[model samples]
Target: MSFRLTELAEADLECIAAYTAKQWGEAQALTYTGQLTHAFRKLGGTPSMPGSRKRDDLAEGCRILAVEKHLIVYRHHAGLTEILRILHQRMDLLLQRLF
Candidate 1:
């Protein structure tokens, strides 16, 4: 299966990088970004892996997978997965309207 990042997901990544850089440092930001990219590849390779959890509130096929302190939200379909957002684990997903 193939995976793609939605525009919002891409924007989320950018914002994450910027925030991490400001709060921590450039190196940490780059490291987290790299981790996120690796997580995306893993999701593409095995989207139904055990650790990923279903999100019924989001939609029929929505799911969330964790990578360290962050969460990767995505929707899976026939031949591809669409990454919807990347958010900090502590953030209230409901307040963000992730559902």
Candidate 2:
């Protein structure tokens, strides 16, 4: 399966990049974002991969995986994995409109 990000997820990534660059450095930002990109590819290739969990409380078929301090929220449908959001682990997911 392939993968795509929603508008919110894209924005989330942009924010993450900007914040990491400002707080750490361009290199660190790139490294962190690259890891996220790698995770995305792995998830696209294997949505059922271990470490990702079904979040039924959030929405049907919703799954989440943690990378560093962020969570990758995604779902599989229509033969593709749709990334709904990239949020900080500290964020209250229940308050977010994830699905």
Best by lDDT: 2
Choose the strongest candidate by TM-score.
2
* Shift in Å, residue 66, candidate 2: 0.4
Evaluated against the true structure, the overall lDDT of model 1 is: 0.87
CA deviation > 4 Å runs, candidate 1: none
lDDT of each structure?
0.87, 0.94
Output the lDDT of residue 30, model 2.
Answer: 100
Residue range 1-99, candidate 2, lDDT tens digits: 599999999999999999999999999999999999899899999997999999988899999999999999999888899999999999999899885
lDDT assessment of candidate 2: 0.94
Q: Mind sharing the TM-score for model 1?
A: 0.88
Can you list the residue pairs that collide in candidate 1? none
Candidate 2 RMSD to the correct structure: 0.9
